[model samples]
Target: MAMEASMVKAVIFDKDGTLFDFTATWGPWTADLLRDLADDAAHADRLARAVGFDLSTCRFDPASPVIAGTPGDSARALEAALPGMTLDAIVRILIERSRDVVPAPAVPLAPLLSELTDRGLALAVVTNDAEGPALEQLDGHAHHFAFIAGCDSGHGAKPDPDPLLAAARALGHAAEDCIMVGDSLHDIRAAHAAGMRALGVLTGPATELPGAEAVLPDIGHLPRWLDATT
Candidate 1:
């Protein structure tokens, strides 16, 4: 079937899961954080549970706020497990640790992004992460994005249209001429609220997103969609 018509001038992506493989990138970080911050094994378990992560499996549950929330949200969740740590301290640690993370791309990023750009499509990222760490993670590939914003970037987070709208403006495109691609419901909701089209991918924990126009295996398929639609 034909997808959207050839009107999309910009593409806004969700960072963690859409661009990179979320679990492969963040599972170790969360596990280490739990163990390091917790006083003991039981405490680690509490921290894990608080964030909806599995210590044994090193996997995040589908509903984990960290999967689609800001660093502040995750920090507050962790604070419930660590009585001694203030939200500020946890956020600092998260940002510090996040700065060094090695991202595992969901697909080859350079070529994919280049393909989209080569087609004259403006690209941007709107994520629930902090601006600092999100930039750090995308350092080498940052050139492909015309704009990048996180929750702390003053645009607000996903499930809200502000950030997406901001990115669209930065990319110099109208909301109707853009698409938001991500791996969660938050992405779809943001796109809908912003009046852009939405596409869902399976690189993240969300296997189904009822709000998306279509769900594909990963971003590798995006070019095809663009081709068909355009």
Candidate 2:
């Protein structure tokens, strides 16, 4: 199970679901953000209809290419409720609240990240979160990444190749040389679109997504798979 630095130039991680528990990391913040969105004149009524103060299952739709996890559903619901608000404004609010939501070390990140870095494999995070919270999680880690790319930092979010491509470039590596580990189809789709290999981790439950190079139980098994041919 030892990992070799030569096998992986860099490891690109999907933040919310893969590196950290999506529900544990984002659930409370999402609830608060949705409540705030509900208070807004533009979104209050619509958000009430979507989830009615319950934030657990209130995600953007699973069908949309623009959306990713259940967290995105709340975001999308807010956007739907508020017709004319700029995407920038909505993303800004979500990102700010996410700063208070911290990832649990129980998710098993420190050692793997340190091991990867120790082996000289560059580490980067490519997430759908806007710039603010993305940086917040990275900042909370005493170990730093070579690059961190957020949705607001580029042309588009997950399922789009831009953010993934940007992360690879920031690491000074080719997309083909990076291993993208995530918990959603959007992560798989984005990595594939960028010509990279992806590993899907079922930190939540089983999903019907296809296209990733492999799927693992969680981040704990990821490092060993960097050289996996399957």
Candidate 3:
């Protein structure tokens, strides 16, 4: 059953596919990174396969670890194709390159976030991306979030309840008083493990994520859902 919006004191969002359009934001970057790392067409293909990316379409597979995995996970996949690169070096490269990729917001973030804030709901971001890049994507809208956590924030990544629980603690809300909004099974699973209500968005490839209280097209629809439920 869907939790009542009146009962929700805070909302924790996932960065990549939840707040931003995943393919529009990351597809070009992935294509460029793969090309930069590979020595030739064959090597590029190998790297794409390793990371579950489709070179022809430059889009990630729905099941790709890169969809919800950490930068370290992406580095590991790249390492399989670029054996000469150290893991730390690969991670650094990915992070540095990510800093330059312009993010495509799933909606007009500032207005939507402001509307939620006006409703007296605290907001936060919990992402598999590093804190720096996550903040970079948030940019002008960073103030909307009361808390922002990344995989490297030391609370551990999704599928573990630490980050979600930490967000609730920071927001001064109980787990049950917060709603976790994301676009992957990892996010829903983590929210469930943390005892928060899970809401899924289709800004990513996911269509039917398990354990979600409700699924909507994107964050743009969240305000209406909240109003209707209340």
Clashing pairs in 2: 59-70, 59-73, 60-72, 60-73
Best by lDDT: 3
CA error at residue 171 for candidate 1, angstroms: 0.7
**TM of each candidate vs. truth:** 0.96, 0.77, 0.96
State model 2's lDDT.
0.67
Candidates, ranked, lDDT: 3, 1, 2
What is the C-alpha local distance difference test score of each model?
0.90, 0.67, 0.91
Deviating ranges (above 4 Å) for candidate 3: 1-6
In the range 1-230, model 3's lDDT, one tens digit per residue, is 34434388899999999999999999999998899889999999999999989888978899888999999998987887788989999999998899999899999898999999999999999999999888988999999999999999989999798999999999999999999999999999899888899999999867778778889999999999887764
Q: lDDT tens string, model 1, 47-113?
A: 8999999989889999998999888889988887777778898899988888877899999999999
What lDDT, from 0 to 1, does candidate 3 have?
0.91
User: lDDT tens digits, residues 92-148, model 2?
Assistant: 666566778867542556677788788788888887777666776767563558778
Candidate 1 runs further than 4 Å off: 1-6
